[model samples]
Target: MPLSEHEQRMLDQIEQALYAEDPKFANTVRQTNPAVHYKRSIVQASVGFVVGISLLMGGMILQQVIVGVIGFIVMLACLLWGLNAWRRVAVGGEAAAQSQTKGAEPKQRRRQQRPGMMNRFEERWRRRQEGDDR
Candidate 1:
């Protein structure tokens, strides 16, 4: 179902947050047009399997049952190729999860040291050293 406008805005916000969080993963997801990818894989696989069946039937008409059987096995294997193709392109969905990972983000600049406890400790130590110097 299509999302309502409100839901769509919400989704957009979430997507922006994700992109902000992890541009690399967002790029990966954008690389795949899933519908086109899946359909091409399925169609190619189906055509291969179908051609294999046609060859099998032609062999049977030639009274070459052994050849026909071999062709049929090949057709089965080609049909399985469809599933394999789908698997190969199926990782696009994981981009959402990747967006949650801080480390997955592409590098910009290195992070500046924050004014956390470590900074505070360093500041205190520096003050003591300066006092000793004086």
Candidate 2:
């Protein structure tokens, strides 16, 4: 939904305040979000690696060794890029998930919640059986 006139004015005022107070921060926020860009770079590099490998294989099949070598270089670059991004994401993902689940961990540790989690699977199964019976 579009903002009402009052909300629009408030938003405009906020934007003005942000720019006036810290134009650099406003511009930085407007540019790119690093996490989003990192994720995208990882995806792009992965796809590029696969495509490059395929091209390399195709060139080899045509007996174009030089072209295949060039393709290998491009694929290696992609692999390095993807690997770096994946490492960053893996480390960050672990920390992020741990933070989100911090409180839940105490409950899990106290109750041996792995079994309870499994009971949830059983509950789902029971519901499915009931659904099937109906």
**Each candidate: what lDDT?**
0.78, 0.84
Per-residue lDDT tens digits for candidate 2, residues 6-104, read: 999999999999999999999989886566767998999989998889879988899999879888998999999998887767657556766767767
- Which candidate's TM-score is highest? 2
| True-structure lDDT of candidate 1 | 0.78
Clashing pairs in 1: none
- Predicted structure 2, TM vs. truth: 0.48
| Top candidate, metric lDDT | 2
Instruction: Give a tens-digit lDDT track for model 1, residues 1-134.
Output: 47999999999998999899999998888786765777798789899898889879988899998879888987998889898776656644456446546554533233343466778788889989889533
Could you tell me the lDDT of residue 34 within candidate 2?
60
